[model samples]
Target chain A: MNRYLRQLKEGILDQNPTLVQLLGMCPTLATTTSLENAFGMGMAATAVLICSNVFISLLRKFIPRQVRIAAYIVIVSGFVTAVELLMRAYLYPLYQALGLFIPLIVVNCIILARAEAFASKNKVLPSAMDGLSMGLGFTFALCILGTVRELLGSGSLLGYRVLPESYPDMVVFLLPPGAFLTLGFVIAAVQKLRGMSEERRRRRSAAPADTAAGATAPVAADGAHSAGEADGAGRKED
Target chain B: MNPNQPQPASMPELLTVSPSPHARRGVTTSRLMIDVLIALAPAAVWGVAAFGPRAALVLLLSVASALLAEFLAEKLLRRPVTLRDGSAAVTGLLLGMNLSADVPLYIPVVGAVFAIAVVKQLFGGIGRNVMNPALAARVFLMLAWTGGMTRFSAPFAYLSSGVDAVASATPLASLKGGMLPDASLADLFLGRCAGCIGEVSVLLLLAGGVYLLVRRVISWQIPVSFLGTVALLTFVFPQGGADRLSFMAASLCSGGLVLGAVFMATDYVTSPVTGAGRLIYGCGCGLLVVFIRYFGGYPEGVSFAILIMNALVWYLDMLTRPRVYGKTRGRRGDRKGGGQA
Candidate 1:
C-alpha cells in the first residue's frame, strides 16, 4: 500500500508527464483553447494511458524485448481508437472541436513514455496505479490551461458568463500564441512554488544541526581552556 | 577612532578594476533612452494635437502600463529594476502612437503589458529580446481585436461625438479599393486627415527622425534604406495611376511607414548591430511593407514588415560579420604557425 501511494505521488507531482517531464504537448497546446475541449481531451488521453499501461504490464513477460515497442504501439492505438469512437458518438461537439488532435492522440508521447518506463518493467497493479496518477496530472494541467484560456479568451467559464459584461475579451488567449504564453507562465509559477517549499524543507532540516554545532563550540572552547589552565598550574608547581 | 579623517593617500577612497579597452565615453543606456524619448516627444505632441484629448489618454495609458509592467516584471523576476532607463517609456509611447485613438481604454493597457512583459522582459529583458517590443504588441493587438483596432475615425470626428464614434476609412482604405483617397496631398502631409494617433503627420515624424539623426541617437542605415526601398518600390509601380509623384508621396505619408522606420525599426535591441546588417534589415522591412500594402489584407504594413525583419536580425548579423583581425595571415590545418579559430 505504501509503495502504491509513493508511486501515485511520483506520477502526479514528482514525474508529471505533462508539466514536469513535458510530454504530449501537441494536445496540451492545441486542444486547450477551452475548458470543455481540454477536459474531454484530458479524460480521453487518461483512459488510453490506463488501458495501455495495464495491457502492456500483463503482456510484459511474454513480449520480446526487440519487438516490444511495435507491440506496445499496437495496444496503445487500439485503446486510443476506442476512446475516439466513444467521444465521437456521445460528445460529438467536443470531438469536432478537438478535430485532428483526437486522432493524433495515438502518437501522444506520454502513453508511450509510460509504457516503456513503467508498465513494461512493473507489475499490473502498480502499473495501473502509475497510469491513473499520471492521467490525473495531465488532466489537472490541461484543465488549468483550458480554464484560463476560456475565461480570458471568451470571458466565460464552461459556456457560462462568470465575469461582468464590461470585461473585454483578449482574443489572443484563444489563439496559438496564448497557448505558449499561458504554458510558459504556468510552468514558471509551478517551479517558483516548488522552489519555495523545497527551500523551507531544507532550512527546517538544517536548523537543528546548526544549533548542535553552536552548542558543541563552547564545550570545545572550555576543554581547551581547562587544558591551558592545567599547564599553567604545572608550570607554577615546577 | 578617526571619524573626521579622510583616507590616507596610501589607501584610496575608491578602487576601480576592470578588463581592457580602458577608453571612456559618456554614452550610457539611460542617456540614449532619454535622447530617443526626446526625439519621440514631437510625434506624440502632434498625435494629441490632431486627435484631441482621447489620443492623450491612450498615450498616457500605454506609457503607464509599460512602466507598470516593467516595474512589476522586474520585481517578480528579481532583477535589478532598471525602469529609470526610460526604455519602457519609449516602448509605451511607440505603442500609443500606433493605436487608433478610438479604441477602448483596455486596448492600450493590454498592448502595453504584452509589449513590456512578454516581448521585452520575458525574453531575458533589455538587449536579449528577439522582436521589437512595440511592433510585436501592435501586431498582437491587431490580430486579437481586428474590429476594434480597425475602427478608425475621421480626423476631429471625436470632437463632435465625445465618446461613441463611427467608423471612417482613411487613405489606406481608399487605396485598398485601387483609388487615391479624397484628401489632398497637402492634407496628408500636414496630417489633417484621419489615421492612427502617431502616424498621421509625416512632417512631424520626419522632423523627429531628423532630430534623432542630428543627435546621433540612431544610425542612418535603417531609416535611409527602409524608406528608400519603399519609395523606390511605390514609384516604380504607381497604384491606381493617380500621377506617379502623388501616388509615391501618398504611399509614403499615408501609413505608419515614417514612424516605424524611424522609431520602431531602429530599436537597438531588436535591430541588427552591424552596419551592413542594418541596411539589409531595413531593405527587408521596406520590401515587406510594399508587398503587404500592395497585396496583403491590411492597408498599413509598417508594423508587420519591421517585425518580420526583426526575426531575421541574427541571420543578418551572421551574414555581415566583419573579418576577424589577424585572419589575413591565414594558416592551414594547424600545419602553419598562426592559430585558426
Candidate 2:
C-alpha cells in the first residue's frame, strides 16, 4: 500500500512526466490551444498509457531483454491505434482536431519511459496506478496552459463568453509564440512553488539542532540540498 | 559570510574599507540615467508641443506604470529594488514616443507593464535582457492592437482637435504605395507631419542625438551606419520618382527611422559591445528596415527591423570577437607541417 502511495506522489509532483521529467512536449504544446482540445488529448494519451502499461507488465517475462525497446514500441503503437480508431468512429470532430497527434502518441516519451523504467519490473496494479498518476499530471498542466491561452487570446473560457465585451483581446496568445510564452511562465511558477516547499521542508526538519549552532547559514549553495537532507536525518535521532 | 570576524568596537566602526582610488567618482548608473533623460528632453518637449497634451499624458502614464511595475516585480522576485536607476523610466518614455498619439490611454499603461515586468524583469532585470524593453513592448502593442497602434493623426491636431484629429495616413503609408506624402521636405524636417508622437521632428531628434554624442552617452557607429545604409539604399533606387536625392531624404526623414536608429537601436544592453559588432548590427538593422519597408505589409519597419537585429546580437558578437593575445593553443600539427613543406 505504501509503495502504491509513493508511486502516486512520484508521478504527480516529485517526478512528474510533463513538469519535472519533461516528456511528451509535442502533444503538450500543439493541442493545448483550447481546454476542450487539451482534455481530449490528455484522455487519449491516458488511455494509451494505461493499456500499454498493463499489457507490458503482463508480458514482461516473455519479452526478451535484448529486444525490450522494440517490443515496448510495438505494444504502445497497438494501443495508440486502438484509441485513434475509437475516436475517429465516435468523436469525429475531436479526432479531426487532434488528427496527427492521436497516432503520434506512440512516440510520446512518457509512456515509453514509464514502461521501460517501472512497468517492466513491477506488477500490473502498480504499473496501472503509475500511468494514471502521470496522465493526471499531464492533464493538469495542459488545462492550466489552455485556460490561460484561451482567456487571454480570445477573451473566452471553454467556448463561453466570460469576459466583458470591452475586454481587449491579446491576439498574440493564439499564435505559436503565445503557446511557448504561456507554457514558459506556468512552468516557472510551478518550479518556484516546488522550490519554496522544499526549502520549508528542509527548515522544519533542521529545527531541533538549529539551537546548538546559532544559525547554519549556508556559506555556499552548491551542496545545500544534500546538506539539508543530512540535517533531516540528524534530527531524526533527537 | 564570515560571521566569526571581530566585531567593531564602536557602533560607527562597522564599515569595511578597501585600498586605492579613495576618491569617489561623480558617475553612477543613476547619473547616466539622468543624463539620458536630459538628452531626451528636447525631442519630448517638441513631441508634446506638436501633438498636444495627449502625447504628454501618454508619456506620463507610461513612465508611471513602468516604475510601478518595476517596483512590484523586484519586490516579488526578492531582488533589491533599483528603480532609481531610471532604466524603467527611459523604457516607458521611449515606448510612449513610439506609440501613435491617438491610442487610448490604456495602451501605454499596458505597454509599460509588459516592458518592465516581462521583457525587462523576467529576463533577469536591467543589463540582462536580450532586447530593448521599449521596442519589444511596442512590437507587442503593434501586433496585438493593430488598428489603435497605426492610426496616425495630422500635425497640429491638438490646435483643431475636431477636424485634424481624425485618422490620417502617414508618409510611410504613401511611400508604401509608391508615392511621396503631401507633406513637403521642410514640413517633414520641422515636425509638421503625421506619425508617432516623438518621431515626426527629424530636426529635434537629430539635436537630441547630437546631445547624447556630446555627452559621450552613446558612440556614433550604430547611428551613422544605420542612417548611412538607409540613405544609400533609397538614393540608389528611387521608388516612382526620377529624383533620387529627394526620395532618399524623404525615406530618411519619414516614419520612425530616425527615432529608432538614434534611441532604440543603440540601447546599451541590447546592442553589441565591440566596435565591429556594433557596425555590423547597425548595418543589419538598416538593411532589414529597407527590406521590410519595401516588401512588408506595414509602411514603417523600424521596430521590426531593430527587433530582428536584436536577436542576432549574440551571434554578431561571436563572429566579430576580437582575438585575445595569449590564445595560441589551436594552431596544431597540420598548419605547422604544411608551412614547413
Candidate 3:
C-alpha cells in the first residue's frame, strides 16, 4: 500500500509526464483551448494509457527484444482505436471536439515511455497501477492548462460564464501562441515550487549538525563570545 | 601614466582595475536611451496635438506602466534597478505611438507591462532581448483584440464628438481595397488623417529620424535601405492604378511604414551589427511589408514585417561577417589550420 502511494505521488508531482518530463506536447498545446475538450482529451488518453500498459506487460515475454518498439506501437494503436470507437459511441460531443488528437494518442510519448521503461519489466498489477497514476498526472496537467486558457480566453470556466459580461476577453489566450506562453509559465511555477520545497528540506536536515558545529566552535574559542557570533554570521551568509 | 609613478593613496579609490583595451568613452546606455527619447519627442507631441487629450493620455499611461513594470521586474529578479536609463520610457512611448489613440485605457497599460516584463526583462533585459519589445507587444495586443487595435478615429474628431466617435478608415485600408484614400497628398504628408497616434505624422517622424541621424545615435544604413526599397517597389507596381508618383508617395507616407522604418527597424539591439547585414535586413523588411500589405489578411504589415526580419538578424550578421586579416574567406570550422590562430 505504501509503495503504491509513493508511486502515485511520484507520478502526479515528482515526475509528471506533461509538466516535468514534457511528453505529448502536441495534444497538450492543441486540444487545451477549452476545459471540456482538454478534459475529454485527458480522459481518453488516460484510458488508452491503461489498456496499452496492461496488454504490453502481458505480451512482454512473447515480443522479441529486437522488434519491441514496433510491437509497442502496434499494441498502442490497437488500444487507441478501441478508445476512439468507445468515445464515439457514448461521448459524441467529446469525440467531435478532440478530432485528430484521439488517433494521435498512439504517438504520445508518455504511454510508450511507461511501456518501455516500466510495463515491460513489471508484473500486470504494478503495470496497471503505473498506467493509472501517469494517466492521472497527464489529466491533471491538461485540466490546469485548460482552465487557465478557457477562463482567460473565453471569460468563462467549464462552459459557464464566470466573469462579468463587460470583461474584455484576451482572445490570444485561445490561440497557439497563448498555449506556448501558458505552458512555459506553468512549468516555471512548478519548478519554483519544487525548488522552494527542496530548499526547506535541506535546511531542516542540516539544522542539528549546524548547531552542533557552532556549539563546538564556541567552546574551542574559549571566552571570546564575539568569535562565535561572527562565525554564525559568516555561516548565515553562506 | 606609468604604474610605478603612483603616489597618492586616494588614487586607488579613483582608479579601478580591469582587462586590456584600456580606452574609455563617456557614452553610456542611459545616455543613448535618453538620446532616443529626445529624438522621439517631436512625433509624440505632434500625435497629441493632432489627435487630442486622449492621445496624450495613452502616451502617459504607456510610459508610466512601462517604467513601473521595468522597476518591478528588475526588483523581482533581484537585479540592480536601472530605471534611470530611460529604455523602458522609450519602449513605452514607442508602444503608445504604435497603438491607435482610440484604444481603451487598459490596452496601453497591458501592452506596456508585456513589453517590459515578458519581451524585455524575461529575456535578460535591455541589449539581450531578441525582438523589439514595443513591436512585439503591439503585435501581441493586435492579435489579442483585432477589432480594438484596428479602430481609428479621424484626426481632431476628439475635439468635436469625443472618444466614442465612429471608426474612420485609414489610408492603408483604402490602399488594401485597391483604391486611393480620400485625403489629398498634402493632408497625408502634413498629418491630417486617421491612424495610429504617432504614425499619422510622416513629417514629424522623419524629423525625429533626422535628429537621430544628426546626433550619430543611429546609422543611416537601415532607414535608408528600408525606405528606399519600399519606395522602389510601390513606385514600380503602383497599386490601385493610381498615378505612379502619387501612389508611391502615398504608400510611403501612409500606414506605419515610415514609423517602423525610422524608429522600430533601426532599433540597435534587434537589428544586425554589421553594415551590410543592416542593408539586407532593411530590404527584407521592405519586401515583406509590400508582400504582406498586398496579400496578407491585415491591412497594415509594418509591425509584422519588421518583427519577421528581426528574427533573421543573427543569420544576416553571420552571413555578412567581415573577413579576418590574413585568413581565408570561410569560417574557422572549415579551415584545417584555424585552431592555431
Worst 10 residues of 1 chain A by lDDT: A229-238
Candidate 3 lDDT, B7-51, residue by residue in tens: 576645666878986887777888888888888888889889988
Task: List, residue by residue over A1-238, the lDDT tens digit for candidate 1.
Answer: 8988887787777777787788998999899988998988889989999999999999999999999989998999999889989989999998899989887888899999999999999999989998998998899899999999999889999999988998878788899988877887777656555555555565566556768575555444445544443333222201
- Point out the higher-scoring one by DockQ: 1 or 3: 3
Residue runs of model 1 more than 4 Å from their true location after superposition: A212-238, B1-15, B159-166, B236-246, B328-341
Best by DockQ: 3
What lDDT does candidate 3 reach at residue B320?
89
TM-score of chain B of 1: 0.90
Best-matching candidate per lDDT: 3
Provide chain B TM-scores across all predictions: 0.90, 0.89, 0.92
Please, what are the lDDT tens digits per residue for candidate 2 over residues A105-171?
A: 9999999998999899999999899888888878877888789988988888888978999988887
Real A-B contacts recovered, model 2 = 0.32
Sort by lDDT, top down from the best: 3, 1, 2
Error of 3 at B214 (Å): 1.1
Task: Note the Cα lDDT for every prediction shown.
Answer: 0.85, 0.84, 0.87
Worst 10 residues of 3 chain A by lDDT: A229-238
Clashing pairs in 3: none
Best-matching candidate per TM-score: 3
Q: Of 2 and 3, which scores higher on DockQ?
A: 3
lDDT of 1 by residue, B164-283 (tens): 565678988887777888888899988887889999988888888998899888999999999999999988888876777888888888878899999989998889989999999999
Question: Judged by lDDT against the true structure, how good is candidate 1?
Answer: 0.85
* Residue lDDT tens for model 2, B1-341: 34654567758756779898789777777777887788778878888888888899989999999999999989976679999899999988899888888998889999999898888887778898878999989988887778778887887777974575767888899889889878999988988888898899999899889988888788999999999999999999788863899889989999999999999999989999899999999999999999999989888899999989999999998777665454432335425544322
Give the range where candidate 2 chain B is weakest over 10 consecutive residues by summed lDDT.
Answer: B325-334
